[model samples]
Target: MGFLYQLGINLAALLLPVSRFFSPKMKLFVDGRKQSFAVLENQIDKNQEYIWFHVASLGEYEQGLPVMEEIKAQYPEYKLLLTFFSPSGFEIRKNNKIADITIYLPLDTKQNVKRFLDIVQPKMVFFIKYEFWPNYLYELKNRNIPTYLISGIFRKNQLFFKWYGGFYRKALQSFDHFFVQNDASAQLLKSIDFNNSTVNGDTRFDRVAQIVERAQPLDFIADFKNNTTTIVIGSSWVDDEAIYLPYLNNSENVKLIIAPHNIKEEEITRLISKIDKKTVRFTNYKTEELKNADVFIIDTIGILTQIYAYADIGYVGGAFKTGLHNILEPATYGTPVVIGPKYSKFQEAKDLVALGSCLVVHNTEELSITFNRLITDADYRNELGIKNLEFVLKNKNATKVIMDFIERNI
Candidate 1:
């Protein structure tokens, strides 16, 4: 199995150039990695000790942020090297201020793994969430460097639990500890006979809770809100728009801030054409026009979290279309959230829905009814928002749990 896995890695490396022509994302996946080792060679300072964090994408980056910040605070002497396996995370946050250096993770072949570990020589390594590259884990273990899985989650049906999963299970042995999100994940690790695990909650809650405490005010958003009820639709796709756009177009005396997931010119233009109400986009809009418009379309990136602070209701997109985006961003601000029906895969969405703090709608009719109730009944909306806020507050100490463990051992 290990031999086959190595073969698979080599095969992928060979095919990456051939796959680049398939899509722009694929091109990024191929081109960005070409510079990975060189970036490490140039940026890594052998004189300074380093701590490494690896995240799959932007969501995992967020999951890793609280711990990263804590580690930097407690150990200021160590430089941080953050690596991403996906372009979505690296492309957007490559210039982030947290990491001393950020680059793409070299592919998980033996040669690439050796070069990466050789260049970085990280004092501590953390794989956020479920990234378990077999070659990388094995090599890190061989070097005797401490590796941990932060906010780890596991399910019974995974390959690691199957009968012919000895190779995969061997990869799990590399981790010094497993800071999992729930009891089920802890139990699954135990089933595999890897007992170095703890049932700490997800670190994402701590990330959002910190954002709420340190949230900065946005004047333009306040101007557009115009002292009226505002619905912030975040990361919406076309299908998600289909569920709520009609209600937004027909509704009156309310403000809608819709930030589509894809902000390409065509996507933004098509969304603007569908709305019959007065609309002002973020890139080029006057405060006067923004104050007068019914809908505010954010065609740019970043600042979504600060905008959520002003929302009475938040419609997070992706459940009906591509995948579910973050609902916790808005929920952290005490905003009642609504999303499409396909949210079962998202644990936070499930928890919020079960608590009656988040609403799930199937179609335009259901979305309309949900919006009307939320708009007309301020007290009920406030109650739901409070519940969501309370839920976030309750789950916030996960970072402390993780940091405490690291302090005792690291």
Candidate 2:
């Protein structure tokens, strides 16, 4: 099994270059990692001690950020090294100010792992959420490096609990401790004889709460909203648009702001064509022009979190296609959230749904009904928004708990 796992990793490395010719994303993945060793050697100080953090993508980075900031504050002597496996994470956060060095993680082959560890020689390592690189974990373990998994969530259906999961289970044992998001994850670890786990809740709650506290006012969004019933469709996919576009086009009193997952011109153009009413891109937005537009399409990034603060109702995207986008972002702003039906993977989404704050719609009809209901009933919307805010407040402080544990251990 170990041999097979190594072979799989080797195969991926072997085929990455070939895959790059066909897929731009694959090309970015390969190109970003091409100078991994060179980047590390040039940037990392050999004499300085460091703490390494590995995140799969931007979402995981957000989950681990509060803890990383806390570590930096307490141990200013240690430089932070952040690594991302996905191109989306690396490309978006390459200019991140938190980490002293940010680069694409080297491939998880044993040799690559060994070389990476030697270059950084980190005092400790933290793998955020769902990233499990077997060779890297094993190498860190062999070097007696303190490694932890933060904000991790596991389900019974995952390979670690399956009948033929020995190698995967071995990978699980490489972590010194598991700071999981829920008791179910802790119990799942217990079932596998991995008792070094704690239900620390989710650090994302803490991150979103902080965002809410420090949310800067967006004057453009204020000008666009202009005291109308504002519906923010955040991180929207094509499927999400298909469901909500009709409602947005027909509704008169409400203003709609869409921040699509892909801001590519073609996609944006396609979205604009589908709408019957006037639409304006965020980049070219003028305060005077906003009054005439029914839909405002955000063509840029990084302002989605702050935009939520101005939202009366938020329709988070991704659930209709993949899984779901961040409902917490809107919930933190006391905006009643509406998501698709496929939010089973996110416990926070489920909790919000149970609290009657999040509305889960299965199709266009359901979405239309839910959207209209929230729009027409101001008191109901306000009540749900309050519950959503309270939910975020209650689930926070996971970062403090994880930080306390790290302080005691390290």
Counted clashes in each candidate structure:
0, 0
- For residues 1-410, could you state the per-residue lDDT of candidate 2 as single tens digits? 88999999999989889999999899999998998899998988878999999999988999989988899999999999999999878888999999999999989998899999988999999999889988988888889999999999999898889999888888887899999998999999999899999888899999998897888888888888888998999999989988998787778888999999998889988989999888889978778998777889999889999999989999999998976988999999889999998899998998899988999998888988998899899999999999999988998999898888888988
Per-residue C-alpha lDDT of model 1 across residues 84-193, encoded as one tens digit per residue = 99998999899999999999998999998988898888899999989999999999999999999998888888889999889999998899999998888899989879
Compared with the true structure, all predictions reach lDDT values of 0.91, 0.90
TM-score of each candidate? 0.97, 0.98
Q: Which window of ten consecutive residues has the lowest lDDT sum in model 1?
A: 341-350
True-structure RMSD, every candidate: 1.3, 1.0
Which regions in candidate 2 have their CA more than 4 angstroms from the true location? none
lDDT of 1 at 148: 94
